[model samples]
Target: MLGSLVDNVVDMFQASNVDWKKIIIVGAIFDFGFKTVLDVLQYRSQCRASPPAEITKTGLIDQTTFIKSQNYSKSKLRFGMFERTISLFQNIAFLKYNLLPKIWEYSKVTAATYFHGGDIVAGIVTMLIIGAGSTVVGLPLDWYHTFVMEKKFGFNKQTFKLWVVDNIKSWVLALILTPPLLAAILMIINYFGKMFVFYLVLFMLVLNVLAMIIYPTIIAPIFNKYEPLEDGELKTAIENLAASQSFPLGRIYVVDGSTRSTHSNAYFIGLPWYKQIVLYDTLISENTSDEIVAVLSHELGHWKRNHIPFLLASGLLNAGLNFAFLGLFLDNASFFSSLGFNAGDMPTVVALLVFSDALGPLTAILQLVQNLIVRSCEYDADRFSVRLGYGENLKTALVNLNKSNLSSVDADRLYSTFYHSHPILPERLRAINEEMDVKKSAEKKRQ
Candidate 1:
């Protein structure tokens, strides 16, 4: 099955432009047509294989009946219909204006072969457009989750006042920061063409390092207040643990996490000199300081392993692939003009997303590979925490978190592999158990 899938993907990539478009259209149609079929199949499989199959007081319906009833609901079937409807409206609105075409016409790339000057400017502008447009999509989803879902789950901390303030602050920050960075990208792409990816990768690394230097000290404070872990046993315990590990963290502190949700977490943010582990107050209330230390240690392991660097590299590689593909596809006039973008004035930046959208399968594969690697790192970090003598504490924290957040413990491997950045609860628990055995053996040797 995997081989066939891989072969099909490779063929799609090698296919001619017309073939590629046909494949895209077919994939999109298949994605729409079979959406409900797959969802229903997976849902039914889960339901059938579910634990504790208790014959309840409510009359039993056979699987056939249940399937029929679910199909009749028609909710699953509407997934593509809703998406298509939204896209249709968006196309209609965009089509009414030659405004975008005029803009593209103005920004036309004149370079014969390599990345041109105009292409870079257009690319940067397009990126900003996407980033801005995405913020529009993302902000609402975040708000919905924070205000509605998280609140319903009893996790919210902020008031309407705080929420509004945070949103405005975030938007202002994006506005202040995005344009110049984007402009720099335009300059590089215009000058370097294909070589722009190299510069982008370097720029991203520097950006991440800068963020590491400043995030805990600056950016984070803009949203939440942080105070030193109070003068108490909790503080002393955390400090002692950090000292023992020689972990180069600046301070242990608490954030008012309960203002949003009952779920608790702890994280190490910023670089070593400025590194601070911010524990949710709710975490302090529930888990012992030991567990918090274990959690912090795991987070510290992420830093030590330079996992963020790994993530940054993955992002840059993805961007490079995206840029290359964009260069390839954007040259095709039909894809551009059909989408209401003027081929002549085609902003390289906007065309970037259009190309990415076209290369959807490759992006998905890239993300999937990256996600699988990240999940493995989560296990490695767990082991690192165990080496610091906090394996049990980490396990305890994970259990508590799962309960508080109401996440299922026993998700399928495929589900976790596909969607989870962190390994699922059972897998993590198993890893912790293995680490505990190693710890006991080391202690016996010490004795």
Candidate 2:
């Protein structure tokens, strides 16, 4: 009966002469429009008359810092609005001009000239062309954000020469990596055909694991220098904490994050038995050893709770769903028509992009659910940190991180709930306080 129902639905869908182009364009509009509305809400929240009393009364942030933070938030919001508007127009232009088809044709010619114009080779060329175009489009915005706005807010630490060097390196890396990656994906699609989704998921899972191993150890150090955290109270304390938990600790390195921005953070990486913790040099400078340890306690809590695997699993599920949907559009001639591809000659890459964009609302919905789950994990990690007796220090560290970074403290409930993977600072603090109270009460009972 279920099979019959699904067949009937599919038959109805096929019979319906849906305007695929219109559906895709409309979805883009709503996707961008909805996010714009949320940003506006968040902007309003940031525009509140003053910082929260709890924050100010505790002297976590002075009035001057609060004002700076508010202004910073407002500036970013204004910038975001402009960028989104530009992006919407760009998307429209790309679709209306049949840019993908033009680019795909160009890629085919280039491939024919060089690589013999096989579909897989042409597909790789097409993706690289798109990537190059996107990189060109985004560079100016990225520069203004990094150099102009961030410098205006006193956060940009990178020199112009360094920035230029960084970009050169990034493009070099992309050129080296993208072709083979695109070829692999295209090959899987060609070989698996109808079962591409399953194969793609497995491939992506391998890529994710490789990224986890490579990014911090290999890729990141190319951009920023890292050094051993010299023997110190902070290192000693971190080691002690790890010892208590029987965590397999390896090398502790401090990354020169201050070279680019004043923002601070710490995280752990590597396989289960030989884990490494990396602290941003900025985090060491901005925070006391205890507060830094407290921050890392929360980070380690994530490891303790296996949040990395959970997040990885969630990402796989998301990718699986994405690929499955793309597979449905494989035989979709009308969808190819919408993408400006000849009905029967549709490339997997074109179908992937068009279907992904057309399904924007669905992805946004998925993002909200993912954010909710991630935020819950954050709360749980906070509780774990508190249980480890770092609650007070963690609270102070949170305040300092926000103050240093000029982060917006006030958040619209809807916007925050929909977008943020971690609970806002105030929410985190409140939860930590509640957990502390529980801990203290339990201690009293034990006595």
Candidate 3:
């Protein structure tokens, strides 16, 4: 009779059960599989034949040599060590408790209890752990990459002091903002449960709007000084063209772009009160005002077409998907509690971090989609520029800029598809020529 009762109890538990041990095993397997695959693919892709000659064909030291001169040994060593440590620890955990089925089963039962209790402090604590860990491990690697390697390549203009100051300021910014935001998100998760997706999507859209409004006026000035375009004929020409196009451009600003790096490009940074077009001094030194105007016109095209709003809408949709995925993990308390999380323990925040880390490949896919839209918008903006003034001038400016920087005219299609935000120079030039031919034909018919 006792043996029969015990067997019945086991059957009942098996019928309605959440096994947490299986989950841990799965996480370990996923981590190992992802890291191995990514590492192998990245190594295979990077190991190309002799460095492209175009990079060094210029009289200056080749970009390849400059890049190689920078010491990445420390970063490589750090990454390898980190990966090994994670793998080792996970293996140890698995070995110590071969009874994943039982532990995981218990973790699921306790998940709800932990969720009920975790609070804001829990979120903040997690943030500090992650922030500090990233700082200690990631910062030095970046320092070596930028200051040591990029400087050797003649790309970095920032002094060590400047770099240190920037890092401190960045950390301060994170400290000020991230904890509260994360805590608030955790609070939201508490009430909404899986329904947190809608709120999260709204929040992302609002954030992007806020950024568009405030960045040029406030956030940008912290990193670089800005002044109105100097009193010159170039300024007059741009203003005149703006008036002709009914472009609501009030001012053009020049930024001290060289303070941080040698790479140069111009961009429009904000909305309305903060709406300003910024030109890089490097651009000023390289191109005529006519060419600069053509560039500015392209930026204006983005604004005129409401591309920013479109981007924001797309971003919100993407955020919705992310929060939905997060909801799946958050609803199951066992999933997180197993990973050292608790309910009153800020489970949402902790779970979020882990979910985000797990979702890296998905994030990459979304980024690729965003880049595709941006590249398409760029071509439209280029067409707008040609309609407003000079396509040839823009092309000339592009050619000079590409040659000066040793920009890769051609790229491996797969690489460009994966990594490039903008289309390659050859593609851009070809598009411009096609537009110009259409324009010329239109003008002849009108005559």
Scored by TM-score, the top model is 2
Q: Per-residue alpha-carbon lDDT of model 1 for 205-282, expressed as tens digits?
A: 788788877777788888777888779877887777777767776877788877656767787776646567788888
lDDT string, candidate 3, 1-447, tens digits:
997986664454334245444544565566556555554444443345433443334334444543442223223434664655664464446434532233333434444356442345645654665567657866766787677756765678998899888888888878888866776677777767656788777767677777777677777887788989988888998788767767677668989888887667888776544466788988888888888888878877887888877877877787787776576556555554454443433255545755654455676688779789878988898888787657978777776666545454545555566667787666887788789899999999999
**What would the per-residue lDDT of candidate 2 be over residues 1-447, giving only the tens digit for each residue?**
998986775555344376777887898898888888999898889878887656765577877888888889889988998888888898889999999888888877888899786777878888888788888988999999999999999999999999999999999999888888988998998898878889999999889878878987889989999899999898899999999889899999999999888887888888878888999888888899999989988988898998989988998888888787676677777777766776577787777667778778877778888898798889988999999999999999999998888988778999888878888877887789899999999999999
In order of appearance, the predictions have TM-scores of: 0.75, 0.96, 0.75
Candidate maximizing lDDT: 2
For model 2 the local lDDT of residue 274 reads 86
Per-candidate Cα lDDT values, in order, are 0.63, 0.85, 0.66
- Per-residue error for 28 in candidate 2, Å, reads 1.6
**Cα RMSD for predicted model 3:** 8.4
Give the poorly placed runs of model 2, Cα more than 4 Å off. Answer: 1-16
Cα deviation at 394, candidate 2, in Å, is: 0.8
Model 3 worst lDDT run, 10 consecutive residues? 68-77
